[model samples]
Target chain A: MEQEMVLKNENSLSSSLKQMLLKLTPSIKKDGIIKSLKNTGITLLSILMFIGLWQMGSKALYNKEADYRIEKALTERGEEAAAAERACIESGDSSCQPNTLPSPSQVWASLQSLIADHNLIGAKKNAFAKKMAATNEKMIAEGKDPIVYTGRASFVDIVLTSIKTVFAGFLLAMFIAVPIGIIIGLSPSLRSAFNWFIQIFKPVSPVVWYLLVFMIVKTLYIGDSSDNAFVISFISVGLCAMWATLVNTAMGVASVDKDYINVAKVLKLGTFQKVFKVILPSSLPLIFTGLRITLSVAWMVLIAIELLAQSQGLGLFVWEEFQNGANDSNSKIIVAMFVIGIIGFLLDRLMLAVQNMVSFNKNEMA
Target chain B: MAYLELNNIYKTYGEGENSTEVLSNINLTMEEGEFVAIVGFTGSGKTTLVNLINGLLQPTSGEVLFKGVPVTDTSHERGVIFQNYSLLPWLTVGQNIYMAVKEAFPKESKKVLMERVKEYVGMVNLSPAINKRPKELSGGMRQRVAVARALAMNPEMIIMDEPLGALDALTRGNLQDEILNIWSQDKRTALLITNDVDEGIYMADRIIPLKPGPNATLGPEFKINIERPRDKTAMNDNPEYKKTRNAIIEYLMDIGDERKTVSDVEYKLPELTPKSFVA
Candidate 1:
């Protein structure tokens, strides 16, 4: 009886432990959690590998460039000059640093430096704002222009400007494309008529669009002193990126299932109801896909337009850094490249999430 | 006057030399509170006929008259259950039905429309899947939603174009009974286009055969004498069921044979004789 009692106690303890583990598990949501965990693990591993490769490549390129520079000095001058160059490189002097590619660590350092620079500029701007705060309020009350900060824009400010311009361009593209797309989609003749126009303009380079927009904007604001580069940049971006949305929307609208159209008809739906209730809902997935592409394209072209228009944006920052050609300038450009890429990815994901929300068929898009 | 009429209808697609005649001389008149079925082979323009009657397609050479007036466009009077179950995939089952109900009764309150949708959805036994999208539902469930959407409109007439063709036999029977039960309630004028003779005989008051295309036309009509609330299991023992079923099958078989011979005549005979005359 004592041995049996001990055995029962042990069994009960083990059973309770098993129950606790079962409770601790994800239960119904176990699959999703485990899947996401596995994905995160793989992503982390891949990112580590990418940094490793980037570091190795950066070292190899630096060494190759250093060796070439030393060899050229030796051939042109003498062994003394080659030794001096080698010592400069070994000492890690900024003057002898390779400018071809920046390592991950260098890019990270440059990001910190840029942040610090932004902080300094931000402090100065704050001081200027405080000094002018009372004067600005008085000017506002008097219905006149206020004293403003005319200092250089910091890195963060530039990024925000770029984002604002891109969003404005995106909105502009949406307004121009969706309505025209719907009109063309509603009529076969209009689609055919616009086909050539869309095809021709779709392939036009962003540079050309920028020039066209500049010509118009320049004429419009010829005598005006207000900033118009933002206007020009957004307009050019919109013109450059609106094609994908227009074409996709037209195709989506035109290719709605005939059966659905019949359903609309049998219900005796009016034209507005037919398009809004039946047609748009049916084609929303494709339309969202078009919008996604348009947004990405707008983002990509926004940089070029801003650069050409000389707007205070990330593009301008990158261009200025490129022209600056300082020791850390290449790394600054690399940092900007990463920021652009990450922002672009997030924008696409934002669109995909919205697309999934509206579309009926899930998992097909991703 | 009939409740719905297809008078001297002729439909052809394309133009000039490219034109193909799809329907020829389709004169069908459906009375109020009547159930009629047009049974035909696949690709014999039965859908076209249904479209013409529903005002989805204009007859190439004739007018579709309803209530003694020419029918030019679609109206809520005729609610259609499409062959492909064209339930918008984006909308849930209730939403799909609600769309039709709302469109049909624009003046109705939202609460009343929701109740009506629920009632019709319950009628089709799809209340369990009322919140599910079309993609989430099975083929049979989708068809049920389509049926609910059409019936929820409370149209004066119901027109179905092979609505259950994609479903399995069991689901088909279930839906047929559900549709018949709802039809008998109001006895609305109904036109059912199908390829199954037994299904036509079981549900419709009269079954008409659409002879095969390229110029398909209606053949003789067979009247069903089966009593209401007919049993599927007992149908085998019924004498009238056997007689009507056999007649329709034989007529369809004869038409199929005729189509085969017509196509065979057009096939060219190959010459196997040696060109060099060396044999």
Candidate 2:
């Protein structure tokens, strides 16, 4: 009966569903539910232990004496003020203490408040748009341009801005690196000529690149503007992030199999056809590897560039919160940290998906 | 006039004291529509000779003439089936053939190209694997794709550098017949470079043995008088097949013995200077 069940499962129309059902049953088989349950139970238990430890540690470190002072200040006024002060202390207000680390509950509440703040901003944007629609229609009738809203960007908007900056930087790096790499890779003389430049520039930090870009942008723009900040930050990010891709692309092109080149030659392909058809396809796996590294570098460099340039992005938001030094600022910063990490992971997976689509060598994926 | 000629070819690598001569005094000629096989041991510069004929490599001191014109660079007139198959792994079997067909006949319509690709794929008996990449196919199937790709271009000459050297005996025999079938249709000028004696006698009208190299050269040509559509079993019983095979084997055995003595003498190291120790 068990053998029949196994065979049926193997030949099932929906094998994924069958597998899931099998995983839910408690059995000694390798793919059974017991193993999955144990794995999940261990993860949950560890997380619970960590939270419990954190809560206990926080209580021990917290200064109730600081709360007592604020309580005494309120009690000196009246019983009603004393009651309000106790409520405030219970509410975990940040103003009562300067150096207190937020408990997990406090951080959670901060997250909820941030969401509320984002929603409130969204409602304000909607109202502004509605109000502007009427004004814009009148302005159009009167042959005048509509006024654009200048509301403060929310946390979600800042995150989007950071994503946009990184993508822009990554694209710029690809455009600059790939063709140059291919050209250098094709000729030994060109590679030798550019070797010094690549070596010298590849190790330069984002800060140094930002300073160089800033000087150029300053001279070119001749005025302080938000657009200039955007240009400087992204350009700096691109400059700093492009080296890996450039080096990898050149290496990839240089190391393509000699047989493939001979095949191209025997086919009597033109230079363009040979490069596009044979060289590029064969070198694509390495090029995609370079691109993935370049993207990660671009993301890492973007934050520093944004912070240095005072641009409207997650980096700037984090830096501003750090400078503010409010009690909730630390929680918000932690939130941004998680967001950045998750986005970086997603970007890597995205590149991996694209690499799989283009590369023929499946073993290389591992 | 000879259709393809290599006159006094001498190919060497590196320069001056570092240079090693590979092919020396390699003079050869083939008539139009003739099938020739060059038999040689491994590392006897057979591939270099094939490369020279295909115009992929320039001779160090000789000219390769195709139809009385000097062979300068590779052209679609000579299609090569490399030993390693050399099908681009990213392209499907049909696509690999189509790439060559499109390059050879740029003026042909897309439909015509597709039809030609399908026809060639069918010719190789790989229609089921038409859309499969080279990596997905076995060695025999990849070699078949390589053959189809070369034949699809309809080149004036087909140069194969031990194309079936890597396959099992059964697959090799099957492909040999398939290649013979294709050659019979158009009778294009063909050259096969291989060390397999039976394969040479089976496939070519003329077989030339290549001597072992420090400077490899063609030894002698043996003409096969066997008729077409020759059955393998029947060839074993044929007097001409046995005589030709024995003569070629004898020649190869003589060269093998000669190579051992030549290498023993050639590879002596220079005497090292002895260092005097002070007391």
All candidates: DockQ = 0.75, 0.74
lDDT of 1 by residue, A7-108 (tens): 354455577765455446534335655788999999999999999999999989988999999999999999999999999989999988767789999999
Report the C-alpha lDDT of model 1 over B116-161, residue by residue, as the tens digit: 9999889988888889889989999898888888888888889999
TM-score (C-alpha) between model 2 and the true structure: 0.88
Every candidate's lDDT: 0.89, 0.90
State which candidate has the highest DockQ: 1
Candidate 2, residue B147: lDDT? 94
For A181-247, candidate 2 gives per-residue lDDT tens digits of: 9999999999999999999999999999999999999999986554788888888989999999999
On a 0 to 1 DockQ scale, where is model 1? 0.75
